[model samples]
Target chain A: MKSLQEQIAGLDDVLSARLGGTAVSLQPIPGSVPVIQVVIGGREELPIFITASETQVLCICYLWSDEEVRADKRAELLETLLALNPSIPLSAFGRIDKRFVLFGALASDARVEDVAQDVIALSDNALDALEALSAYLV
Target chain B: MSVIGKILTLVRGSAREIGESVVDANATRIYEQEIVDARNAIMKAKSELTGVMAKEMQSAREIERLRKEMIRLENLAVEALDKGEDALAEEVAGKVAACEAELEEQSRAHANYALQVGKLKELIKAAEGKVREHEREVAMARTTESVYRATRSISDNIGATGSKLVSARESLERIKRRHEDLADRMAAAEALDKETSTRGLEQRLAEAGIGGDAERRRATMERIRARQAAAHKDA
Candidate 1:
């Protein structure tokens, strides 16, 4: 099988059909690794970033940054995220320094539909996370 | 520490400071090497399992040879007894007993080797699974660095001039606006319903100085004043 990066890079027309009505599009972000930014139809505000190595396919959707977070509600927001993590399924809350993100990983050999599902789920989860935690933002 | 462990530690120290350095290059390399080590461990176990399997085959062969020898000796003992050679029969019987004991020992050895083979194979299988998981973690950690750079650049671009990526606040703003719109729509619907009702028509007529509550109130006020004047005159 091709690397997940390449496979995701080629996920243009099929995932949209898989999603039924929601359009799915991908852009190959040029960098050190093969990272593709996927913007699903309904969740256009949240674009998922995916890249794969020999062993794993990782997808991440950034929710917000610390700078965006209100200082007074920071603790409350962190607590909310931790409390909500397990229930969200498939994805976990993580912070990339200042950026808060929801990340999910799967084996590199997963099918394209599986990857699409992961991306969709992650994107949905990200939007929910943002909306639920919006009060914490500046 | 694992890359994830390192990230958690850094995050705990100060989430703000844990940005691009969550899994440094060295930590990532170390993590990749751990996958290599796990694979090597599985290979060693496989080799050991092979050795155990070989020992089991040899022990099985030993047991088979002993059983054949025992069968031959028993036949000889029976023949000696039939030919009126009691002492020869006793000697053959003793050799047969010795063969039985050795056969029992070989069987036990083979069983132990078989058990070890099963255990080693299971261990190797589990180790391989662990290695695959670790490899996945390393892949994610490495890819995350690229993500880190990309997001950093995005953040910079947004700060310099807004990008296509809408902020969370913007989405929230839209959501709030929708709620406000719903409130406004509800109020407008109520007003429209009232405007088309019979009561609304009466109120509009009164306000327009047509014969309604306004004229009746004016006549009642005049009658009250006349009654007050008649009472004053009688006083």
Candidate 2:
């Protein structure tokens, strides 16, 4: 599995490129979870979640901007990043075999343990699922 | 009334799946009971049929005995007539005819009882068939109820989570906006105070009439005013 630092770096690059003129930042949460911040149209910084393990990786994006347009932009950035890299399998990172759950939401708890088991299990990552979210940005 | 009801209407349908789940559950139970009742009825009917069959067999045996008695009486009548006893012969003949008629009636009664027993057996078999049919229906209903319940639960959870997330985000944004507004007001107030102070300083300098002139000219003007005032005092 990619280390939290490496994944954050990759995310920073991907988000920065996809959203020009937007400053993006990534920090590792206390427990090796990577938290991403993307400046939406230079207006608001949106936070997203990415979890990686040996066998699975999950990503969830939350809308942080209060303005509708900035929210839209943040959503677009999320969609683009997900489309470009998709969710990388933790097994591909070597030696990580546990399930990784990624949930994107700023107001709601991003903590996986608090969420319902079925919801986490339903979370899936694919290039296509990311692309499919693009239409929802507006 | 519940979120689940609204969601069910949207996805499954208003009239169909919503009520169908409960209906199906109840139907499943009812059919289950129906199957049990049907089996019981069939069992009772079978028992009744068995009893009727046994009674009919007994009646048939009685009819057979009567038939043999009639045959023996006819034989005695013929023997009596051959011996040339007219009165005795007449009496024997009458007894033989009466016995034959009675046996015939008994045979008819046996046939009727056998028919009734056969019909009862058919009814019992039909009831058993119905029990099997009811069992199949109950199974189907149970499967449908389980599927519906699962679907409803999933939808309810999704709706609950989605609304909760949205509400949390709205509240956070509200708090952040309030903070920003307070900060903006404070910045604007500080700027206004600075502007007011700068304007007061400009008014003071203008009243001294030393505002916006060449530095040397203002100093010279001040020196002349001071000397003229001193000379007037000496005079």
Candidate 3:
């Protein structure tokens, strides 16, 4: 069995091969999930945090949130986010650290390619959802 | 007929003739016109599709701008709150709220436009496919019409040639009948001439009493034989 770092490195290799010119680097943070920063399309770096336990490696991309969501629009935003969650594959909208985030996770036995693809999908869906829910979020 | 009636009759006659001529000469032109109409329709649809996509893009851009503004206003509100400026934080919060509401509406519009663009693109694609199919059908129809025309012409020519052959055969039969009739008449004339010549010789022979000559000669020979036999007996 490979370590979490090795699995992430494999995922990085696959992503680099699939997405030409995409730069993938691993940044280990003390006492927290290790972050994989991916630069795609020569744009801003998308940071993906990964946590590995005994059985599963979870991948997450922290999207925007409305911590100060107005009382009137909170229900509407929650509904919108809920509606969008099921539509985006391998991703969901949930509150994390006082902020709503769009995130996805995969099993430890999952292929690196699947993990990389899911990470890309999760990021894309997060950005898209943020754009979609921008008016509902503060 | 009155002058007005005559004019109306002439007009109707001319119109009918013109209609017939037009129909005869404009088959291919009509097909071309249909294709042109379909192409125009496709172009219009394509233009509409492009407009829908442009609207979708615009809405998406608006939503993206509003999202960025919301993020900025939220950060500003957070900073104001940290600095103990409650009024400023409230103002920034109000701005964030406004931006969020606008962003939500724009995002909804963007999603709707995206759906519209998708449907329009599919429609345009289907129309293009139909146009191509119709074009192929028109080409096949033209080829088939040409082949049909050639076959009709060949059939007409064969019919004409068949009639000519029938007439020729009839003429040959008439000539053959005439030849047979002439040969029969010549034979009859020759027989009549021979009988006319032989008729005088037979009449002369009858007139010279040659018909009784053989019987009379036989009787005279018999009488001489009997007299000779009697004389031998006397001797």
Candidate 4:
């Protein structure tokens, strides 16, 4: 049972060698449940926060909030998200409170390389999601 | 509701494993209560299975005891017949008959209990799988709640130059900017590559008076000028 911190550290090393880009920065979000934010280089705008529970290791990227949604198109935006869920291979459309997000989850014991790959896919998917669904935004 | 339907169906559908915010607190509470009820049901079934198994064991013991008593009575009857006591032998035979009947009843009861145990065990196995599936949903809800709190904290100020609160629109703009920047760099490098190609290098060398064609032309023009100057002076 590897900790989420160890997973992220392993992922950082893999991404560093594979990408040859700037190093990924891991910041801890001050919360009770131990969450860490991973900002990938060249895709820093879409920072991903990863956390763990007893059952799963979860990652999320906030696409937009309720306030950013067009006032008349809330339902439409949600419907689109539901429809778009299948298109993004590794990520899912969801919400954390009023803030809509693109997220991925793996078993608590998933491999570090798998998590790293998911992060990259998730980051790219999030950017594409925002662009594709910007019509619903204010 | 279908798994891919409206937001109202998100928590109750198959898509729950992927996670979505539980917008209705009341609904979520009822769902949690249902999980508790199912858990209780599983516990009840497990205890009932234990009781059935115990009964099966008891039936086996009774069958064994009755068989032993019947065997003893048959031995007595044989002894009575050998001594020519017909009435005593007949009485012993009656006792053996009674034990046989009792053994048959116990054997039947044991079989039924064994069947019930098998069924209950299977039921419990299936129920456990379902409960685990629902528990995963509850786990997802808790995780989503945690994410909500954490993201709420991070959403302090939007677009504060390296801040976490950057909006999606601004983030997209930044992504595009980085893409454009990379494109510009690539174009610049390609242009530099072309400028240093074999043709461009040869042209550069000609301008510097060290190449074949340009040196020959310059020398030829200089000789022509010298010849004209000499012919004019001679004339």
lDDT of each: 0.76, 0.51, 0.62, 0.78
lDDT of 3 by residue, B1-235 (tens): 5434433343344433422232233654765677787788789878988898889888988888888888998999999999999999999999999998898899888989888888877877877776775565455443223322322332244365473212222333443466578789999999999998887777676577665555577689999999999999999
Relative to the unseen true structure, what is the C-alpha lDDT of residue B88 in candidate 4, on a scale of 0 to 100? Answer: 100
Candidate 2's residue-wise lDDT over A7-123, tens digit each? Answer: 344455455554553455554433222332222222232233344433223344333222322354665654554554435432011001111113422112222332222122222
TM-score of each model, in listed order: 0.59, 0.37, 0.35, 0.70
RMSD of 2: 23.3
Model 1, residue B87: what's the lDDT? Answer: 100
Could you give candidate 4's per-residue lDDT for residues B1-235 as a string of tens digits?
3222433344344433323344356766776787787788889999999999999999999988998999999999999999999999999999999899989889999999999999999988887876776666666556555555555445532333354566789889998999899999999999889878977889889888888989899999999999999999999
- Candidate 4: the clashing residue pairs are none
Angstrom error of the Cα, residue B135, model 3: value is 2.5
TM-score of 2: 0.37
Candidate 1 lDDT over B90-139, as tens digits, reads: 99999999999999999999999999998998888888888877776665
The reply for model 4, stretches above 4 Å from the true place, is: A1-3, A20-22, A71-74, B1-58, B61-85, B97-141, B156-164, B198-200, B203-235
**Model 1 chain B worst lDDT window (10 residues):** B10-19
Rank all candidate structures by their lDDT, best first, as comma-separated numbers: 4, 1, 3, 2
Candidate 1, residue A75: how far the Cα is off, in Å:
3.1
Ranking by DockQ: 4, 1, 2, 3
Off by over 4 Å in 2: A1-138, B1-22, B148-235
> Can you tell me which runs of candidate 3 are displaced by over 4 Å?
A1-138, B1-34, B155-235
Candidate 2 residue-wise lDDT, B132-198, digit = tens: 7666555434433433343333224447557333322343455457658878999999999999999
